[model samples]
Target chain A: MKNTLWKALGILILVYVFAMTMLVPLGPGLLEFQDVNQVIESTREGRAVPEFQVIGFGTHWDQLPDSLQVFVQSKGQLAALEVIRVDDATHATVGLTLPYSLPAKSWNVLTNHPVDGTLLLENGLFLSDRFIDAKATWPAPSFIEHSSQLGLHFPYQPRIVETIRNLMLHVPLWFTMFLLMGIGFVASIKQLSNPRNQRDDDRAVASVQVGIWFGVLGLLTGSLWARFTWGAWWVDDPQLNGALVTVLVYSGYMVLRQAVDDERLRARLAAAYNLFAFVILVILLMVLPRFSESLHPGKGGNPGFNSYDLDSALRAVFYPAVIGWMLLGTWMYLVTLRMKRVNRQIELLP
Target chain B: MQGLAFLLGLESTAIAFAALLSVLSAISSRAGAGFGLTAVLGLPLIIPIVLISTRYGTDILNGILWIDTAHHLLFLGALTGGIGTLGFILFPYLWRD
Candidate 1:
């Protein structure tokens, strides 16, 4: 009954992890930026900034407020105008720009370029003017107000937007892998201290099995992310190659364990190799490559950590992702240990 | 059997719903599947729906379509729900002798 309960809990936890990963809105959706022609016609009677209306999925023609006037009347040719509306509850904002050109009885309909027509409520949702806490008015020139000599504007890459969510999955896999391997290292060290204790040997073996799984998951998620972000499944990056080498060394530990038949001798030698492999793994994965230029984080030439990456929404989902996956990994280890015990019980029955 | 197709379809739908509920559970508990299953199921459902809506959704939104968007959502929901429930029901039996 207790075993079944644990198994049930494990399944529930596994399902939960998969669930959060999907439903969490942590990445960019269909983004559209179009040059809207808002024309203000003046025939010497008076100058009026012409009001323009755009009709689309969320905010159709009917949703337009009768109280709110269409155009911001300006004296001079408006170089850049931005309207920011912040939602009081979620604190998310939508900024729309007023582009050049508007004439009498002229209306435009601009749909999001890559419209996500998901049945999900978030897909076609639009920011209503009512829910806004405050609106910040800024000129286009204000964007470059900070710097004049150097202005860096990253190209709008779709892959970068999609791959941003991968930070939760791939990075956590490595973190969990490191953590598992660290446990293995400690267990191996303990076994080295007391060569007589079989429990230490079993623990060390279990850690390696769990650690290897995490490493494999890391590689798979990383490769998938690489395929999307870098346009290739395998890239010749320093960090990528180093991680592969680290995983391979750990794999060798498994092979070495199987080669030896004597249990005592196998445990002693495998534990020693595990300790060695772990040190090398840390150096390869976390230390050496970080100093050099690499595409992967923690080992890259990029100095900034949170700049343009690790947005608030992504962070909210990411921390939990790490915790959930790590817990799941630990759960798998427990199950494997139980299965091993069951095998021994059946073995003794004969 | 008619029941089998309905059962499979229902299981798929249940798995889909379970995927959603599981996500909410993860959020509250800070542990579990996280968001993998929803994403997998979402891809097939969301992509087609989003594509159909964004490009052709204007007509649907304007109420010109023969079938409402709700119906489509229902079909998808039912299909996923059915399948997910079927899977849950079969889990115990799967390991049984």
Candidate 2:
């Protein structure tokens, strides 16, 4: 009864993770540039106001005109601009009057829509020193601000959008794999300490067998995610390579077991090899990857999932997925142990 | 101080891999003339680690991100750790017969 319940829980949690990962929508945010008018050098020097058009995605365009304000984000200050026209939903033209003391270089154009919040178009306008007088004192622009919306949606990361959902899948599989392997490591220690006990040897082999399955799943899912986000099925990433090496080393452990003929000798040699494999797994998966720059987050200088990636909404599903997968792996290990015991019983009957 | 550390790391990693290869060869030979076979098998496997460590060591000497080098140092720890644990656990088995 307990076994069936644990298995059911694993399946249920996976289904929930898959559904939530696919269903949640990305928050309303700036998508891309629609049309931007070039700021001419002579016109920039003159006193006339400069106008530009921008298109936005996931924005509440209907609350425009009165509630809309635009700003040129330059030199750490937000310079407010006048909204010349609202062309349509998702389109607007805003005008900015340059101060005599404006800083040279391109400034980001930010729109403050009451409903959509602040949307930014990076490097929207360029002010060359060739046009503006160098000695002119730049006018400080007033800050244009808007209240952020309250809703449940995925955070807008620059590169990863829908693929961010893979976090609940890819990350948790590796975590579960580690948990299973940790069990194997402990079992191997017990087998070595008391070489006479056959159960400890069985437990070590069973844990490893299940752990390898999880490791393979981790590699396959990671490869799929990498193909979409990193633009290749495989990149020369340290983390990915380390994971590959770990799988290979563990696979070698299975090969070693097959070559030995004597039962007790096979068990002892396998236990020792399993311990070696576990240590190498730690080195390859956890230690080696950290030193090299990798596309995978939480490695090198990149912020880990804990920082901004695993937001509250993600954490809600992510934690459960890990626990579910771990329980499932443990259950699989127990089944393998039972099979080994049954096989031994049959051999004794003969 | 950093250069000395890099040199120490490089030498230690090379020594460790060599030692691990020798141990692996010794174990494989129990089956047959397995030293040659094990060397042939293991050299290819360990080359990637050696190549990466060399490249990373150069990066360290050239004043790349110190944090990055520190992470690579962990890789060495892992290599030594696996080799060390395997040696301790498996040596008795090899000596039993």
The 10-residue segment of model 1 chain A with minimum total lDDT is A113-122
User: Model 1 chain B, TM?
Assistant: 0.34
Off by over 4 Å in 2: A33-35, A38-55, A63-66, A85-91, A96-110, A119-150, B1-10, B30-48, B56-78
Clash pairs, candidate 2, are A101-A137, A101-A138, A291-B71, A291-B72
Q: Residues A168-243, candidate 1, lDDT per residue (tens digit)? A: 6788788888877887888887876777756777777787898888888899999998888778999876577667
Deviating ranges (above 4 Å) for candidate 1 = A1-14, A26-158, A303-308, A341-350, B1-97
In candidate 1, how many Å is residue A236 off? 1.0
* lDDT by candidate, in order shown: 0.50, 0.73
TM-score, every prediction: 0.51, 0.83
RMSD of each: 21.2, 4.2
DockQ values of all predictions: 0.01, 0.41
Model 2, position A7: C-alpha lDDT score:
87
lDDT of 2: 0.73
